[model samples]
Target: DVKVTQSSRYLVKRTGEKVFLECVQDMDHENMFWYRQDPGLGLRLIYFSYDVKMKEKGDIPEGYSVSREKKERFSLILESASTNQTSMYLCASSLVSFVMNTEAFFGQGTRLTVV
Candidate 1:
């Protein structure tokens, strides 16, 4: 089975702190994504990388950034965290299969709180 592992399950940080959230997948999938989940806004994509050393910004890319130096790992970085950025962050990976549609497998998520 494919597994997405997040570095931290919960995090508390002071305002203006820099944060790094790590994610790794063992399935050798081609795509990886980062999303922030808020109550009303639902899951909003922050960034995604389709291959090593390549990435595309998703809808909400203002305060978030991503790195994909390797095929199995993707990292999300908050460059100067803020109070409004407090939310649940999820990491997911998937493969596009021509024979059968594949679904993205999500991590348990890392809930981040900025004070």
Candidate 2:
């Protein structure tokens, strides 16, 4: 089975602090993604990487950046934490494909709280 691991299950940060969230997948998948889930707003993608050293901005990339220097690891960096940025962050991995049939396997999510 494919597994994705997030660095933290929960995190507390102060406003304006820089935060780093890490994710690793064991399946050697080609696609990795980071998303933030808010109430009612659903999951909003923050970043994604399809290959090493390659990254792409997703739906909500402001104040955030990503790194993918290895095939199995992806990192999400919050330049400056804010109260509004407090949400459940999810890391996912999937096999690269042109069809959307492949489901994204997710980690247990990191619940971040900014005060």
Q: After superposition, how far is residue 108 of candidate 2 from its true place, in Å?
A: 0.6
Of candidate 1, the 10-residue stretch with the lowest lDDT total is 94-103
Off by over 4 Å in 2: 98-101
Each candidate: what lDDT?
0.94, 0.94
RMSD of each: 1.3, 1.2
Residue by residue across 41-112, what tens digits does model 2's lDDT show? Answer: 999999999999999999999999999989999999999999999999999999896396888999999999
TM-score of every candidate relative to the true structure: 0.95, 0.95
Model 2 pairs whose backbones collide: none
Tens-digit per-residue lDDT, 1-115, candidate 1? 9999999999999999999999999999999999999999899999999899899999999988889999999999999999999999999999955245789999999999999
